[model samples]
Each structure stands twice: as structure tokens, then as C-alpha cells.
Target: MVWRSILLLSMINLLLLFSSPPLRAEAASTSTVRPEFARKGALTCMKCHDDAAITQILLTPHAVKGDADTPFGQHDCESCHGASPEHVHSRPPEGALRDPPTVRFSGPHPSSLAERNAVCLGCHENGQAIHWTGSKHANNEVACTACHTVHIQKDPVLVRDRQATVCFSCHTEQRAQSFKPSHHPVREGKVICSDCHNPHGTGQDMMLVKDRINDTCYKCHAEKRGPFLFEHAPVREDCTLCHNPHGSTKPALLTLGVPWLCQECHDGGTHAGNPYNASKIFGNTLVAPAPQAMARGCLNCHLQIHGSNNPSAPFFTR
Candidate 1:
């Protein structure tokens, strides 16, 4: 009886194995396999992307092999592009596109904005970029690639001479203002957009480099930042109240020339209420031409117009 039972059990086991061949194959195929890195790193990517623009990244700071913080020091191209095993090894179907890298900075079918930024923020979340999270550029969906070109050896935004052109691409109004008659020395490369404004964002308004607009002006115009006995109310309040820092048609970047600019505030003062015009200067009139109507206007007497340390200079005049 025992021998008969053993033979029956062996026959049942063979039948089960034969009937479930598809299940056995499926189990083997579904087993989890880890994704792989390209064997030759950037060299493998260079096989297809061997253009000058792509290859020039080797000369950039990002390619420093000695710095473990850099891309080359870590996973080479995979450090920024991500481990793209399928992109490296998979074959595409007929007339279909091949797989793309995990993170793409640009190109038609590029990855999402958040995905691309996350990859950059992975390595650049500190320093000047720390305030980038809610910055105007980030809020407006401005990508880092919009201003920066990592593949290039020298990024235009980082070059003082070429920086304004990059900034002008978006700041069209400022660009027009920059070309005005009385303007900052931006075109001459003596001054740059970054000199006063921090594109990375700041706690100040208009992303000024300093806490206040006046403080930004004080960087170059230190003489104006005085603890004077008599201070001009407008000068203390805000520099933009009388001057346009970007550019202006008036001399000295003033919104309006001397007496006119001063009259905006001093309208009720003695002789200040009088309008000085061509009619007042040349036309036959009973009233004589006021001294304030001369070529230098209010500036003639108010030599210390900005402020005064003199004991008796009540009108900001020394």
C-alpha cells in the first residue's frame, strides 16, 4: 500500500509543474532589478552628444574632478542628468522616440520645470540661491537655463561686460532706460546690473543689494550718506524721489532739473512758488528775472544741496 501511494504522489507533482510553466516564467521576469549607471559615465554620453557646446562643459567649474561636490567628482554626467539606464541601453520602436534622461534642462520634450530645478537645487540650494525659492524669477517660472549656460566655458551672466545683455533680455524697460542721455555707466562696463540689484533675490524692495534703496546708492556715492546737521527730506526718504538711478533725460539723472525738481517739494517757500520760464527770462515784464532762474538755478546757492554739516545752513546751503 505504501509503495502505491508514493508512485501516485510523484505522478501528481509532475503534472502540476507541467501545467504551471507560464507562472514560473512570470515569477522570474517580475523579479526586481536595480537600475544601472553608464559604464563609461560622460564618455558614453559623448558618443552621441559630441558637439562642441556639450563637450565644452569639461572646461567649466562643474567638471572639477578634485572637488567631490562637483558633478564629475561624483557620478560624472549622471550626477546632474541622473542614472538613465533605459536611456543608455533601451532600443526605440519603429518611428518612436527613444527614452530621455531623468532630468533635462532644455530641448522640446524636456522634463517639467520643477524636476529640472530640483536637480539644480540638489547641488545649489545654499549661498546666493537660498532665497530663490519664492523669488520673482522662480515665481514667474524663469528657469536657471534662461540666464545660465552651463555647457559654455564662460556664462554671459557672469561676465561683467556681457552681463547687461543677459539682464536686458527680460528687463526691456530698464534696457531702454539704460540707453537714455543721463544714465549709469552700464554700457561702458563700469557698472553692472548686479552692482545694485541682486538677481538671486533679497529682503529689500526691487531686489536691491542693500536693505534700502538709499543704502544701495551709498555704495558708490558714500559722500551722500552723511549725518548732516541739515538733511534734505527727499534725499533721506528715498533716492528715487528725485533721481532715476537707471536713466533719465535730465542732467545728473534727476527726474527734473534743479529748480523744477526742488519746486516739487519747495512749492510754498519764498520765491519758490514763482514759475521760472522763457517768458520770465526774455519777455518784457515788470518783475525782474529771479536769481534762482539763472543757468545753475537753485544749485548756485545750495552748493551743499545733498546735506550740510555747517552750523547755520538751514536750507541745505553752506
Candidate 2:
């Protein structure tokens, strides 16, 4: 019996020696726990939230190891939210533990412009938003939350392809354009709203960071912005004069395209009925390929269709 007792005592000492260093490291890590902020509050957060879940929160991304570091993890409720002071008090105001005022993500709707936009501008000062103050949205009283939601993890804007929904909400005209038979593939989610429009502000018209609407389009179509051997004056002037910037009922966003389109100005009755009878765009009983070989209609040969340095007819033809 004496030998057994001695062995048990030795085992206990060995266990303590092994565990002490880890415990001490843990206590040191939490040493920064503010005395005023750390309370064995009466209402433990887990008391209602359930032990497994609160434990999960600490494990989640929103959980921060230290204050003033990277963003608190999503489920890391205590990081940006602060330590639950009254949590142990057991009688935290019914919603006392509710979202703090610093949490600008929520809404009963901010009473003022600064209050509403403040939530987002605090973080998103870079990127497309550097000059948002006098931009159209700011002037129109459109709040950041009016189009976006920071805390809303499940919304469409947070997703890549669906971000356009936020823009379409205000651009009802785009919505109307898509209803037509020959519009862009917006309804199918191919072209996003940001593709053409800069939601943020710029000194340019309609908040376009590009000086002109055609300049804005030239980015995607570099080939079209060139000073071609042959120029199409009307095309260079403003593509919108003959084209619909948004979707169109004419396949390629063209206002009218082909025979009827060219005839508007090219009406010498096809050079007074030349050999091929060019006046009848539908020659040989068919509109085989209207004017320009019919690939995307007029956009085919008039590749520099937007404008050309050639200066000939500048009628967007070869």
C-alpha cells in the first residue's frame, strides 16, 4: 500500500508539470484582456446561444485573435462587436447585446445623408469610389446601403455575376430595353451592369470616368477606336446617333441596321438603279446580305465603325 500511494503521487506531479506550461501560455495570450471589459458577466453569451455554437463562433472567421487587426471573422461576434460586458449580468437589456451603434450595417434607415453613407465610405475609399461625393448617385441622394449591403452575406450584389441587380434597380430603362427581342444578353446574365456603367462617381457625364460615351466603349473594342484608312464621320461623331447604347430590337444593339438603315442617307435610289439594281436592297428576291456582307450586318466591314481617319464617305462603308 505504501508503494502504491507513492506512485500515484508521482503520477499526479508529472501530470501537473506537463499541463502547467500550456495553461500559462494561454493566460499570457489573454493577458491583454482589459480589466474593465472582462467581466464574468451574469449572462454568458452561450447560455442562450448554446455551447456548441458559441464555441463555433470563436472558431469561425469573424473571431479575431487580437484587436486592431484584420477583419473579425463573420461568426466572430465578439471582435468588432466588443466583449460582452453585461453578458454575465444575466439581465443584459432585452436587446442590450443587440448590434452596437458602431455597427453601421443595419437599418431602420439612417436619418441623414452622412449617417447613411458613412457606413460604407469608412471602408471603401479606394477603387472605383475615390470621387463619389459630387457624382450622380451622391447628388441624387442615393446612399451606399441603398445599393449595397455589407453584412448581407446572402444577397446577390456580393456575388460576381449578379451584382448588376443593384444597378438595374435604378436603371429601369435597361430593364425595359432587355424586354425587346434583340437586346444584349443581360437577361441571361452575360453582361453585368458595371460592364458599361461606373457605379462610382467621376467628373465625366453620367459619372462615366471616360470623357465620352464612345471612349467608354472603346476600352472593350480597341480595334474600333483606330484612325482607319477610311473614315465614317457619323460613326466617329457619336455612335449613339445611329445606335442604341443599351439593348436593341435589332440583334446587335443597332437602332436599325442594313438596307433600311443605309437607305436613310444613301438614297440615290442605289445610284439610279445601277447594274445590280442596288436600289432594291432585297435584290434577286432576297435580302441575302444587306449592304456589308451581313456578318453582324453593318458592323462587319465598317470595323472602325465608330470612327475613321480615312474621311472618304465616312458613311461607315468600304
Candidate 3:
């Protein structure tokens, strides 16, 4: 009876070994398991990151090593910076200071752009970073650290009021445009760059937050995106046809002054091409003067230039 029981136990162990292939394959398909360098060094994070400047990363979400799903949760700083056995060794240098455990994102001797981006993409490949590999910023060799400061508790680019300042560092022309009198309230902190643009790679042209230019503009200017009885072809085609989203010298963010803007498409249609004269614009006569330059020039007559829902407003004059 004892021999029979031992035989049954041997058969069960063999059966379990045969079924283990499927379990091993499932584990292989998930994130690759990395060596635990923190354990090998017999050290804690604070051992090396003792300074306030570098230790501040502990205050952020990246330092939560208990999660097990994230890089930090897996192996602390070594998860992103890489497992550096050499960096942990206390060997005296011969000529120069020893190399870093991993190539850092930003510094006098920073890692290559591809290397820096690859580290960020390890966990951030979902969401907005999905198309980052082929995006304009990637093509231009812009590193993730160029705009993001991960070590700090608060990154300036993440703040709405301070976000534009970071963008203006690279977008000098936009900085000048936003300073114009008739501009979006970017400087005042009311309007922000992220409202229109997605800095993290988007499928749209110019990294727009929305798929289409008009659709992006319609988020704020929904009244302008009308299915009116009289639809202007240019307005339907694109908002950029008449308006500059950045600042302009003209009111309403127009690319040009009213009469001149209207003339871009209207040409010499009726009195559209007629330039404003001093007699009509300045001094008043007995008869009412042509309001070519008075109240928004051509817009004084064609009030519904965007579009008109009214059936009688054929020329968008209503």
C-alpha cells in the first residue's frame, strides 16, 4: 500500500511538469523581467540620491516602488536609469570620473535622442506617445527631457499658466505673435497653447489637439461652426482662410483689415475693391458717407460673415 501511494505521487509530479509550458509562455509574453540591481548592491534609493536636488523624485509618482507594475515599482531609479553594477562599485578612478550608471536625458554630455526617448516610451507608449516615433518632434530629434523635468515634483510645462513660457523657448515667432494687441489671452494665462496643440505627438497636422483645424477651433468658437442656410465656402473649407489663430494687428484675429480681407476673395465685386478716401472716412458731409472704413469696414454691411441661419441672409448681410 505504501509503494502504491508513492507511485501515485510520482505520476502527479510528472503531470504538473508537462502542463507548465503554457504557464511559462504566458509569463514570457508580458513585460520582460529585469535583474534586480538594487538587491545586488545591498543599498536603498537614498544611499546614492541623498541630495535634495536628486532626492526630490521621491516626492513624485515615479518613486512609488510598491506598485510592481511601473518601472519605479520594479527596481527604483535603476528601472529607468538602467542597472549599473559599475556605478555602484566604489573603485577609485585612474584618469577621469567614471561613467554614469545610465546615459541621462539632459546634461552637458546627454544621451542620444533615440536613447532618451526610448526610456520614456517604455511605460508611456500608450496614450499620446503612441505616434511619437514618427512625429515631428521625434523627426527633429527632440528629447522628452527637452520639455519635461521628471526629477522635479512640479514640471513647469505641466502648469497651464507656465506652459506657454516653455513652448516660447522654442517658438520665438509665436511669442512675438501672442504679444500683439489683438491676440489670444495666452500671456494673461486665460488661453494656453495646449488648448489648440498636443505637444505629445498627435495624428493631426501641426500637432493640433483635434483631427481638423476647424474642429479644433470649434471647441471654443462653436457658434462659428454653423450649418447655416447660406454657408460661406471659405469658412466651411478652413478657418485659416480668413483668420490667423495667433495674434494679428486687425480686430477679431483677422489676417488683414476688413475691406482688404474681404477683397482677397471678393475682388472688384460691386464696391468691395473701393479703397477708403479721407472724404468718406474723416469729415462728415450733409449726405451720409460710405462706411467703408468706419465700423469694421466691410463687416459693417456683411454682419453675418461667418454664416447666417436666416433664409433671407443670402449674402450673409443679416
Index of the highest-TM-score prediction: 1
Model 1 lDDT per residue over 1-318, tens place = 575446434533433443254335445665552236665567667778756667667768987666779887666788888899889886999998779888888877888889888888888879778888888888899888788889988988999889999989998999999989999989767899999988878866788899999999999999999878999887888999989999999998999987888888887535665644333433655344666778788887788888999999888678
Expressed as tens digits, the lDDT of each residue in 1-318 for candidate 3 is 675446444533443454355336546754454433644221244465555566556557775544666655555677777777666664756876655677576557777777778888888889668878778888888788889888777888888788889989999999999988789998777888989988877978999989999999999999988989999899999998888888988788889887878888875535566544434434554234457657777787788998988888898889
What is the C-alpha local distance difference test score of each model? 0.78, 0.55, 0.73
Best by lDDT, which number?
Answer: 1
Candidate 3 runs further than 4 Å off: 1-36, 40-45, 94-96, 275-289
User: In every candidate, how many clashes are there?
Assistant: 0, 18, 0
Q: Which prediction has more favorable TM-score, 1 or 3? A: 1
Give the clashing residue pairs of candidate 1, or none. none
At residue 64, give the lDDT of candidate 3: 53
* Candidate 1: regions farther than 4 A off: 1-35, 93-96, 275-287
Which one wins by lDDT: 1 or 2? 1
| Candidate 1 residue 170 C-alpha distance from true site, Å | 0.9
